[model samples]
Target chain A: MACDLSPVLLSVRVALISTVLNMIMGTILAWVTENKRFPGKNLLETVIGLPLVLPPTVIGFGLLLLFGKHGPLGYFLAEFLHIRVVFTWWAAVIAAAVVSLPLMYKSAKTGFASIDKNLEQAARTLGSSETRVFFTVTLPLAAPGVIAGLLLSFTRALGEFGATLMLAGNIPGQTQTIPLAIYFASEAGDTRTAVFLVIVISFISFLITYGLNWWVDGRSSMRKGG
Target chain B: MLEVTVKKVLTDFTLEVDFTISDGILVLFGPSGAGKTTVLQSIAGLSIPDYGLIKLNNRIFFSAAQVINVPARLRRVGYVFQEYALFPHMTVKQNAMYGIKGCKDMDGRYKLSVLDVMEMLKITHLQDRYPVSLSGGEKQRVALARALMTEPDLLLLDEPLAALDDKTRRQLRGELKELQRRWQIPFIIVTHDRTELNYLADAALFLRNGKPYRVLNRNKEQPYD
Candidate 1:
């Protein structure tokens, strides 16, 4: 029997959306925190990074409280905006994004920090505006770290399970990602389907890791050659 | 003409500088940690001073009392860093053209053209190369070309030849002096090399402990050391 491919498709879509969101939010947050000083900066960074250490179920519970039907946000969103987010595909995306944000943030922060600040000052003296300097110099220099962060977030989102299971539920054809589908397949004595999904996930993970290694190695070699 | 009277207090020391530059090269001669770079930075609008004023060509670049601090991009000053600080990701051509595209003068025209600056610096052939691929002298020339693309009223070079070998430094010193004479803009150079002072400086300012110790005019044959 041909195995269903819907779960794989849904997983890829959710991961892609979540990774893009993480990329934007992570890069901005990293840049701001790296370059600016403000009161309570450390606290803010710690709070954003909490998800990395917290249990996924705990995060899911928090999200559940915020987005559940009787919850304040859920009630306001449903009654006023006539929109529901719980147990939906968007909920999976949000869950994955929240869980994977810290990884991107940390990597991008390091990237920005490693750049020589004198370069930016030189640009300023050359009559480039702050915005132009950032786009022309800062961002390009930090591209490798940002790209690495993006790939890590993408893979993390693809493998997300616990929070997604809690917030989005295991609704077939809607929110049943590969991880959840594999779980259900194993529990239902469908060993073949579970094995297939495990292989697919492993293969994807290998490709991502290999790609990251290749890119990093190529960059280092170019630097050495130059 | 540029006039600067600024005071900045750092954790280890306080920088109190008062100087004036009309035209030709003015060298800031001092040992390391004498706050030479700080003075240059303040003039370039990169370092904010706690008090006093910086006037360039009669325009108030910074005035603490009046709160008239123009942003760095509008200051129209070229600063070439000691490290040459070229954007490693950009080609020499892109780096040279960076300042020309974004800045505009009062009448709404670019200050200088990339082609003109690159040709003037003789770095037109290296425009397609990246900074990492260029030799130290080539990098320095590209940096100067990039800075000149803005058509600055004043040029500030912080230890411009410090990173090159002795032979390269000797050759470039003469080239730099010739360029300054041709440009006719006030050039402020920070260096500890006494020979460099004799070779290029029309005047030299001796700085010690973050303060101006003395000002010497090369024409007067004042002892620099």
Candidate 2:
């Protein structure tokens, strides 16, 4: 029997969209947290990093509560905008984004923190606006780490299961991703499809992680050589 | 002319200074932790003082009493950091051209061109090269060129020769003095090297414990050995 490619396609799409969202949100959050000082800054950082330690199911439960029909945000959306977020492909994207965000944020934060502050000050003295200084000097220098973060986020989003299951539900040709499809296939005793998805996910994750390691290593060696 | 009267409390000492500097090279000579760099930073608008004013060429750069504080980008001061602080990802040309894009003269024309400053610093051949491949001396020239691109009213160099070799340091010292004269702008240099202080400074301010101990005019004195 021919393999159904819809799961693979949907998984890739969800991962791609989630990775882009993660990159933007993570970069901004990392910059603000890393450079600015304010009261309760530590609390804000801890909240952003909560997903790293919290179970995916717990996160999914929290999201479900927040986005449920009677919940405050859910009420506003459903009442005003007439949008339903639960148990949809969009829910899959949101679940993957939430779970993968911490990886991107931490990596981007480390990247921004490692740069010399003097370089930014130098740009300021040269009459560069703060936005210009960040875009021109700070962002470019931190690119390698940011790229690695993006890769990790994509892989993490691709492999997400429990959160997607709780928030989006496993519906064929709709919210079903590779991991969820594998789970359902095995439950139905379709070992062939399950094994095939497992191999595909493993291969994809292996390539992404291997590329990240190679890039990080090349960057460090380039720095040392220079 | 630049007039500075400010006070800032550091962990080990308090920096309090009231001085006016006119044309020529003025050196802040002090030990490492004596707050020399802090003084330069204050003048460049990078650091805020507890109280007092900083006036450069009749422009109020900062005034705590009047609550007037010009941001660093509008201060029109060039700061060459000790390590040069060149942008590692950019070519020398890009770094030199950075400030030129934002600056304009009275007629609304761009004040200085990148090629002009690069040629002045003798780095014309190295414009396409990145900072990572440049020697310390080349990096210093690129930094100076980048700073000069803004057409600053004052130039500040923090430990300008600290990162260079002995021979290169000696060579750049004469070039630096010539640059100040040619540009006809006030240049404030911070350094702990006695030889550099004696050789390049038209006057030197001796600082100890974040206070100005004395001011010496080198016009009539022999060089310190």
Candidate 3:
């Protein structure tokens, strides 16, 4: 039988979109949490980091309560915006973004914090406004961390299974990403397709991790040489 | 018309200083932990004085009484840090030009072109180089170039030449004096090196124990040492 490639395409699409979302939202959140002082800062930090330690199934359950038809956000979206997120590919994207955010946030924050504050003060003495200083001096210096976050988040989003199954549902050719497809194929005793999907995922995961290591090694050596 | 009277409690001893200089280089000569850096910080608006006032020309930088504190960004103060806090990622040219705020005639605002400043500091050839590859002297010049580009009314240096070798330090001493004369701006240098005081000080504050024991100016014909 010809292998169904729909899951592969769907996984890539979901992972790509979610990674972009996570990068934008996560980096901004990291910068804010790192630089600013405000009330509930610790609470906000805990919430952002909760996804990493929490079970994926538990996250899906929480997401379900928020996105169910009669739920608060779901009700407003359906009535006002005419958009429904539950049990759809959109839900898969949301799940991936939420789950992978902490990796991005933590990495970006560490990168920003490692910089000497004097560099920023140097910029300030040059008449650089706070916003300009961030973009010019701060953000460029933190770029390696941001790129690492993007790569990690993409891989995490790609392999998302438990939460995707619960929130998006494994609809064939639509929301059936690689992990869900592999599970269903194995459950049905379709060993051939299951093995093929497993190898594909394993290779992708290996490549991502290897690429991350190579990048980090090269960057550190480059810094040392400079 | 620069005037300052600052007092702030530190970890060990209270830093109480009151001095004024209209022009020329004024050196704060003291040992480590003597609050020399703190005094420069206060003048640059980087640190606020607990009580007293700082004024340059007529602009009030900080005042505990009036409760007025102008932040460092708007204070028009040039500060050269000890370690030359140049942006490692940016080239010498970029760092040099980083301070040039909007001026159609950049010559008129800062009273010198960016290229001229780099040339005067003799770092024009190293424009494309990063700070990491630069020698101690080159890095110092880049820092001075960056600060001078901003056209600050008063310039503050915190052990600016401390990291340099003796030869470079001696060479820069004369250059700094010439620079002050050409720029015609008041300078406050924080250094304990008596050699620096003898070579560069038009006025000097000798601090022994967090208190300025003597304030000597050239017009008074008193020896700095």
**DockQ value of candidate 1:** 0.81
Model 2 lDDT at residue B155: 99
lDDT of 2 by residue, A1-226 (tens): 3388889999999999999999999999999999999899999889888988999999999999988998887889899999999999999999999999999999999899989999999999988889888889899988876888899999999999989999999999999999999998999999999999999999999999998888879878988988
TM-score of chain B of each: 0.94, 0.94, 0.93
Q: Give the per-residue lDDT of model 1 (tens digit) for B116-146.
A: 8788888989989989899899999999998
Candidates sorted by DockQ, best first? 1, 2, 3
> What are the per-residue Cα lDDT tens digits for candidate 3 across B1-225?
789999999989999988889999999999988999889989887788899999998889898989999877888889999898999999999988888752122443326688999999999899999998999999999999999987888899999889999999999999999999999999999998988988899999988667987777883745332
Choose the strongest candidate by DockQ. 1
lDDT digits (tens) for residues A1-226 of candidate 1: 2388888899999999999999999999999999999999999899789888999988888888988999898999999999899999999999999999999999899899999999999888877788888889899889888999999999999999989998999998999999999999999999998999888988998999899999899989988988
Task: Give stretches of model 3 more than 4 Å off.
Answer: B65-67, B102-111, B207-210, B219-225
lDDT of 3 at B207: 80
Pull out the clashing pairs in model 1: none
Model 2 clash pairs? none
**For candidate 3, lDDT tens digit of each residue in A169-220?**
9899878899999999999999998999998888988999999999899988
